[model samples]
Target: MKTFKLNPYRIGFRTIKTAAGMAIGVIIAKQLGVINFSSAAILVVLCVKNTKMKSMQAAWARFASCLMGLIFASLVFELLGYYPVVLGLIVLLFIPATVVIGTQEGVVTACVIILHCFNSKGVSLDFILNEILLIIIGLSIALLLNLFMPNRSRELEDYKTNIEQEFQLILSEFSEALKYVDIKLDHRMIAHVQLTIEKAKSVAFMDVENHFGRNDNSYYHYFTMRGEQALLLYRMVGLINNVSRSDQLHQQLSELIHEMSQNISGHDHTAIRLHDLYAIQLQLKDHQLPTSYEAFHSRASAFQLLHELENYLHIKSKFGSLKK
Candidate 1:
């Protein structure tokens, strides 16, 4: 028998918070003797999100939508009387109204309120007040649960470090490939880098939204720069894949790539790296052309790689300047 290792599936903090908030909302609604108390729990499940800003926005939208639904249901059902046809008309009219008012996020909750009115046989002042109470209970619980969002800066930093390490490994592999020291390269690392960059950017944006009146978006900007550089890395990898043979040009380009990998960290010396890349570009331009088509293609690829390297350095420089 062979032993198998299982991958871990971790539950996110937001999910746990939502569950706890829903439980609390149900308890509060029951204690207050609000009819249809389960509706409050449903609203809590719907409104709570990963960040406090999002939760607050969602709660506001749901509250507004519920109010509109209550008013619309009362008018339509009271004037025309409760009928299946009236319910159909309400759905048709209310959905468009919610969309027009930009409270579309609350559409489902609005429908829940409308259905409660139908089940209760008519919309009355008491029924409307009970629905409003449910909405308040749910939104209040969600808001309180999301009040103290834990700072994710440390997690963002960890993502950045992982991304940097992966980038370094990719550059080291490129250097070895150019030197004819490695024939096998894992292209999957490119996809991994892309995924990591996306995760970092998401975390950074959440961090920005967690605060108020803070204009500093250094982490967001940093991940955005890395995203641009990742595109250049993709192109570089494509060029490297085309090289079937190595020569003197390959050797020189390999040395340059090694230098680039070293300078990728502590981007303070990016100016110097850009200068070196320019010199290499000029040297490649003026050098004698190869007779063989394959060698010529290889040199051309190296030239393109140099262009990408220069762009990468410029992006690093711009990001570094933002910090100062």
Candidate 2:
């Protein structure tokens, strides 16, 4: 809320900067008695658009765009203004149309140019000056309103939570992905893999964007951790896919998953089912005994290994070690 209220003023300040342009405009406009208020109002957005370089980029972009627009608009409108109503309305319409420009620089420049076109008259020299004064008023109001808004950091945290939840949603799809693969290991399997991969990458990007402001090391570390977690899931899926397609289920892969699941679900190491999965993997790999997925499924093991693995993997990735 505070940022919201202050945002308007910041925008106005940007506008005022453009209109005044090193204090000369403000001094001259105030002195000449041709000051305008909206000048500063538009500059704020230009600065905001360049906020990627930590607000400095925005400031420069805003000022440069605004000034260039003003210069161009002033010249064009001067020639066209012989027909005041048509020229004035056209200029007015053009100014606001720039509102949807989607970038700070574009919007600010458009704003200034439009203002020049709309307000230009015998007071061409005073146009920028007048705008500079109006900028102060708009900025001040925005500043005052935004003074006590809610904590922006907290809002960022909420966004972070949402991103994490979206990541989890991808994780939840894994079992479905597996079951689908079990039915037919076709191109559809690749589609699920791509979806999960993209979703994980997006989560990593969001975390990077929202986690650290300018501190590079911490930001990299956080993202690196997330990448590691994502890779683990990728590894797990690869293991499961192999089981579904292999002529004979691979023993090591099955044993690893079986042990990992037991570790995940907090199931007893001695549980009959967990032991049986290990035994099944060993027997199948060696062609020693029972030779089917159905036989493995029919046994009433003490705990479901796959379920335990999924839950544990999710918990470990999203949170800290469950061992604690």
Candidate 3:
């Protein structure tokens, strides 16, 4: 559910690659000359996949823009024939008209119209009509191709991987913060940690929606549990304890993670659930849990680890990739 400015450079490069490939292939296929509009339809197909909500918006825009361009081109060709004056007039109108179209939809349409008219001597109605027809054919093919294609589900696995990595990172960060107990933390570091955790939680939820979706019957309960665990970590962020107990808790947390990683396969889900006393053991190297903020942080670190485990399990369950 997050939107940000699209990376224009990346998008532009991708567009160029696609257009070049399409044009080359079309040129090679000039024998049939059937793919002109159809191959160009890729622009719309890819545009839709950019975001779920934006999927159709770009495609529709392209279609409408092309329609307008086609109409304009057709009128000019019919009335002006291929005369230089007529050609120049169409050129004069095309740029301003395209600018006003103001979307990819318009741009695609304009491109199609321009391409169709480029080899013409006069405003050729047949040329314009052919482009229009090809655009329709191309769009239909593109839409159907996209519709049948399966979207990647790697995001679900990535969600689990990211959470696992974050747990390690959070602890690494927490471990560092502890080392600097005497040194005040830079506000920037704290801000970074906070931002990471916030984004992690949001991404985890979104992962569930996109990949480990609830429509799958088994995942319903798993998603619920995962959400609950995220909440637990959010609340525990307020309850960290950094004291003599820190060292001991750290050891215990490490052991907990080791044990939890074993359960990644979920081959025996009940086996994991039945294990009791997953608490941290061992006293700190020499200290008890520290006071106040230290204690909260110590406890928070452990809680967050558990929270990540909770989310991971849900992903496994939803995806049904768990070995056991």
- The most accurate candidate by TM-score is 1
What local distance difference test score does each model get?
A: 0.82, 0.43, 0.48
- Of the two candidates 1 and 3, the one with more favorable TM-score, higher being better, is 1
Q: Which RMSD does model 3 reach against the true structure? A: 10.0
Cα lDDT of model 3 by residue, 1-324, tens digit? 888876645454334444544554344335446435444545443453422323345556666777776677667767767565765677677667766766544564566455566455455456656666566554443343334323334534454455545444543543444344453323343344445445545433433343322433222333344444445444433333332233445454444444544443354662453242232222333445456775656665655644554555454445554221
> Which segments of model 3 are wrong by more than 4 Å?
1-55, 77-105, 148-151, 168-324
Q: Which should have the higher TM-score, number 2 or number 3?
A: 3
Give candidate 2's error at residue 304 in angstroms.
25
TM-score, model 3 to reference: 0.45
Instruction: For residues 232-283, write the lDDT of model 2, one tens digit per residue.
Output: 5544554454444233334333444434433332334325444555555456
Decide which is better by lDDT, 2 or 3: 3
Model 1: clashing residue pairs? none
Clashes of 1: 0
